[model samples]
Target chain A: MGNLLEIKNLNVQFDIFGAHVQAVRGVSFELNVGETLAIVGESGSGKSVTSKAIMGLIPNPPGKITSGEIFFDGSDLVKYSQKQMQKIRGKDISMIFQDPMTALNPTMKIGKQIMEGLIKHQNLSKNEAKTKAAELLKLVGIPNPDKRLDEYPHQFSGGMRQRVVIAIALACNPKILIADEPTTALDVTIQAQILDLMRDIQKKTGTAIILITHDLGVVANLAQRVAVMYGGKIVETGTLEEIFYNPKHPYTWGLLSSMPKLHAKTDKLLAIPGTPPDLSDPPKGCPFAPRCPHAMKVCVDHMPDYTKLSATQKTACWLLDERAPKVDPPATIGVGGE
Target chain B: MDESREKLLQVKNLKKYFKVSRKDTLKAVDDVTFDVYKGETFGLVGESGCGKSTTGRTIIRLYEPTEGEVLFDGEEIGGKLSTKAKKNLSRRMQMIFQDPYASLNPRMMVKDIIAEGLDIHHLVKSDKERMDRVYHLLETVGLNREHANRYPHEFSGGQRQRIGIARALAVDPDFIIADEPISALDVSIQAQVVNLLQELQEQQGLTFLFIAHDLSMVKHISDRVGVMYLGNMAELAPSDELYDHPLHPYTQALLSAIPVADPKVERTRERIILQGDVPSPVDPPSGCRFRTRCPFAMEICAKARPKWHEAGKGHWVSCHLHDDGLKK
Candidate 1:
């Protein structure tokens, strides 16, 4: 499959008063056709910032894409103006936000909202748009689609509202769908339903999916490949098994061990100590060096480059250095997938 | 860990209904029953609007129970209690709120905020005594006395939760109801707070009624757990037993839906996806609340509410399939 989207050395910054917050620092990745790529990170780790930067949704003046190129359809989106980006956003790449209530207009009917994109991008008439909207709703597995199209945002449940939001995102058959924690706002059962529906949609449409979430479980559940971000940088990127089974970076290890599992009974979870580094004045060396358990003396003085583990896996960590002392993840910690 | 281990708190057929309109009653918590043993953590989990929080609030007498009994230490304290008795009850049972930022007063000093319980019951004789108590609590929850002068906004989410834990411990209560205590914190910080809770429970011999929507985290810390759906207890059993042998369809769905962090298991495992959202508690279904989303739903499920029974040893479940084993 061809690469649907490729981001190269992307840098994003926000100026809050006199201080500058480096939100995304040289983050790069690729999304291939019909493949799911999950970006996993904690808050302030720049996971959400990377997704927003891709959509050209970052507020300018305050938030700016300072450097790098976002290549989609063999073109750079970083230099694209607001008007040009609008066309690409709806027709080429669409995003489904975490909260459907905030994303959807409360007063408008569900059908009109779903049809707006179809009518505008596909050039369909009002009656034709209505027919397409119903099909979209049914595709997202909303029951009794014909009668439900007339309902408002509040009339539908949280899960149904999220389903409607997905329906809208798929209305134009966008090439790439960036779902920013799409199921985070819904319940677990509903989250499963949404995740299943998204997988079904991807299989049918062969759409490239970019799933952004803080939950490692969700990443495991959906993504074919995983990129673990920490302090605005892609610390580790690999196939799902590499990230889960043989994660090298201390940050990725900490994240995986921090979460308590369903099948395993462990006395204590290994929490990563300390908070994320301040983006206003980031650390001179590796940003995660402060909290890294396997951090070496050189980690504080210099940042490590990505070490290629395999064709699909690369990790940035001082522990990967040949000269550094060998250290392993704590014994009590487990993969505990089942 | 035995049958006669002593029930620290017994909630018998409790109900708490709010008057939404003059005629319409919002049944936030309907006839639910459970017991918290001494020094055991009892986890209550459900999705939003399932009355898990309401049950915790009602047990602490934050809201007056509309019906049924809440017996603590063999004394009924559900209805109209004397002010002195209520004040005494407050000292015996304290609550840790879900939102640390909103729970702590922004204008007040951390020391004063944590000592709010100390001053209420007149637990301290002098200012030095109160300060000493506050400082001791901070250290107990992994903070130092240096945090006494700061405000709630000064701390991060994890630190703020630690301060919240300190506030709850200042009263030296027998039972602490934590309402989604770690939900507000990030993943890295969640386990820290959970560890702290477990440590304090061991040190002080405290009984916890942990309320949260996260089933995985709840399963980690809870001794026994109860599954709630639309104001009713769908299942209740020991944590391991419940997770290992889930009988109720809702419980099975809830457990299966939790995404495992390992990709191999996630890809291979069969997930049970419920069909619809939780029905409105105001006009709940005639029988089981889960029948709307249950995969093994039968005609009898709608006809009558399934009787709560012990399907296996120490595992209680409410489902028509478990009502009585029969040829279908």
Candidate 2:
């Protein structure tokens, strides 16, 4: 499969009160054609910043892509002029936000919102756009698409609003879809429906997805490959099984063991101690070293290199070093009563 | 699981309705009943607009119930009471709000925020004693004493939640109503708060009415859980029984909807995606509230409300599918 989008050493910085906060620090990943890649992280981990950078949505004054290359298809999106990027944004690569209501214009009808992209990018006529809008709504599993097209956003339920947002994102049929916490604002059952719709659409359309979320359960259901981000850096990149079962970094182990399993009774969760790093004054060593249970003297002073574990697994942690102490993960790290 | 355990709080047929207009009334919580044991964590879980939060708020008397009764420590707290009795009830049953950012007053220092309860209850004798108690509370919630001088904005979300916990503990309440306490926090930080709550429960022997939308976490911490749907309780059972063998169709759908964080399990597990969104609470479906989206819904399910029946040792379910009389 050909690479659809590649982010090479991407770095994003925000200037506030004469201080530079490094939001995304030297992150690199690739999205294969028709594959779903999930970037999992907590709030302020810079997952959103990296996605916004890809879409040319970063504000220059406060937020800037300090260094990096966003390669879409064979061209670099970073070098593209505003005029050129505008043409490619919706037609080639589109994005969905966390909140559906904010993403949509409440004053406008749902049909015109979906058709706006069709008319702008594809240059379709008003009638052609209207027909396509209903088809898009139907594609996203909304019942009575023709009638729903005439209704305003406020008339729709939260889940329906999200489906309409998905319809708008899919209107142009972009090759790469970036969904940033698309289901965070929804209920669990509604979240399941939206995830199902995304999977079903991907199967029929073959559109590659870059799903950015903090929920590991959503990642397990959707992503083929996983990239774990912490304090604005990619700590680990692996296949789904590798990331979940044979996780290398301590941060990944902390995230897995901390979760309260549904089918089992655990007396205590192995919660990572301390808060996330402050980006304005980020740690000098590993971002996770402060919270890691097995931190070493070397880990506090230096950032380790990415140690390749398998054909598709790589992690950045000093514990993976050949000379470092071999420590087994806590027994609570496995999933689903394993 | 023992029947001999003392019930700390009893909520019987609690109904809270909000009048949206002159004619229309939104039944946020209607006819809900449950009991919380002396030192147990009773979890209330459901999707948004399912009335779990409203149920908690009603029990805490944040919202006046339209009907039904609430008895705390065997004393009726639903109707009007003396000023002294109301104050005592407020101290005994404190509430921990969900959003720490919005719950804490931004202008106040951490010391004053934690000591507000102490000052309001007149528990402290002097300013020195108040500061001492605040320092002790900060330490109890895993925060340092130095944090007492800081403000809410200076702390992280996790730290702010710790402050909130300290504030709740300052009054030394026996029963705390924590409504979605960990929902607004990050994943790693959520575990921190849950562990803190568990540790505090053990140390203080405090009862918790933990209301949240996260089923997995609820299962882990709750001794028993009540599943609500569209302003009605669907099922009530021990956490293990509810997760392992769910009886209500809505509960089954909800359990299956939660994506387990395991690729192998996710690939093989059969998911039951409930059709359509939760119906509006204002004009909820008749008979069984979940009948609109239930896969096994029968004609009688739409005609009559299913009686709450005990199917196992303590597992209670309200579903036509489980009602022996209806099944026959």
User: After superposing candidate 2, which stretches have Cα over 4 Å from the reference?
Assistant: A334-338
Q: TM-score (0 to 1) of chain B, per candidate?
A: 0.98, 0.99
Q: List, residue by residue over B176-285, the lDDT tens digit for candidate 1.
A: 99999998788998988998999899989999999999999999999999999999999999999999989888999999999888888898999888887888888888
State the displacement of the C-alpha of residue B31, model 2, in Å, after optimal TM-score superposition.
0.6
What value of lDDT does candidate 1 attain over all alpha carbons? 0.90
lDDT of 2 by residue, B10-99 (tens): 999999999999999999998888889999999999999999999998887888889999999999998777889888988898888999
Q: Give the lDDT of residue B133 in candidate 2.
A: 92
What TM-score results for chain B when candidate 2 is compared with the true chain B? 0.99
Which residue pairs collide in model 1, if any? none
**Residue-level lDDT tens digits of model 1 in A1-338:** 88889999999999998999999999999999899999999889899999999999998789999999999989999989999998888789999999987999999999999999998889999999999999999999988999999989999988899999889999999999999999888889889989999999998998889999999889988899999998899999999888888888888888888888788888788888888888999887899999987777888888789999999999988888898888987764444455
Q: What is the TM-score of chain B in candidate 1?
A: 0.98
Candidate 2 TM-score, true structure as reference: 0.99
lDDT of each: 0.90, 0.92
